[model samples]
Target: MFERFTKPARAAVVQSQVEARRLGHDRIDDSHLLLGVLAQEAGVGARVLTELGVGLDAARDAVAALHAPDAQALGALGIDLDEVRRKAEAAFGEGALERRFARRRGFFRRSTGHIAFTRPAKAALEDALRQALTLRHNYIGTEHLVLGLLTGGSSTAGRVLHRLGVRVDAAELRRRVLDELGRAA
Candidate 1:
């Protein structure tokens, strides 16, 4: 199945793990896959997302927003998340508390290496192959990857893309990607 992936598609898969690590996530979810798609600037999926104003940084920020720690939930445990956030911000500057793993001294304690892909992520990759087959494409490309994200409808990546697209919902994005592929063909 990997043999069917094009260069850009393979890059997206590898980069998904990189994005997960950068975001302090142990698992690569569909959102990370979306970042992988956005990272491939020359790929059609990347270009289409960029045209819709969804760049890599913006996508990263969205991922961060989605994964923000729940202060109320933490407060229930008597942790006083707000106070911790304030002190951490004062000592480490802004957004220090927002990160998943905190650094002690110079070392990050969390496992920064070997990120596993979540079930949804694996499903998306499998769906990418299905998308390529449906389109009668010889190789799976980044465009198919974008379609794979949308196939799940309520997936993390689909929701993020829809939110990022603003006026254009996930379905619209799916259409635009397919249309762009058609034009390139």
Candidate 2:
């Protein structure tokens, strides 16, 4: 199945792992895959998303927000993250989060090298293959990947894409991606 991936599709897969690591996530979710597609600027996936007003940075920010440390729930308890960070930084001299992680590494530690793909992410990849076969495409491209994400409507990536104002739910995103692919060809 991987052998059928085009250059850009392959890049997106690799980028997804990189994105997961960069975001401090031990697992790669569908959102990471979408971020990877967005990172591949020359890919039709990125172009289609951009045309729909979804930029890579904005997507990254959205994914990060989802992983944020329950700020809203904590705020309900009158615990302000910003204020906590500020106070911690003032006492610790700066980069308090970094220092905390460094301290944890000295004692509590595990293999941080491997990032497993969450079930939804794996399903998206499988769906990409199905999409390619359904479309009678010999090779799976970034467009197929976007279709896969769209098909997995419950995935974090799908939700983020929709929230970012893409027309994935309405089924127009596939058309936009195909249009971009056509123009690219």
- Counting clashing residue pairs in each candidate, in order, gives 0, 0
Model 2 segments more than 4 A misplaced = 77-108
- Estimate, for each residue in 41-60, the C-alpha lDDT of model 1 and write its tens digit: 99988988887888899889
Model 1 spans > 4 angstroms off: 76-78, 82-113, 167-171
Candidate 2: tens digits of C-alpha lDDT, residues 59-121: 999999887799889999999999999998999778755432312546755436557789999
Give each model's whole-structure lDDT. Answer: 0.84, 0.83
Candidate 2 lDDT score relative to the true structure: 0.83
- Minimum summed lDDT over a 10-residue window in model 2 is located at 96-105
TM-score, per-candidate, Cα-based:
0.78, 0.81
State the weakest 10-residue window (summed lDDT) of model 1.
95-104
TM-score for predicted model 2 compared with the true structure? 0.81
Q: For candidate 1, what is the TM-score?
A: 0.78
Displacement of the residue 137 alpha carbon in candidate 1, Å: 1.0
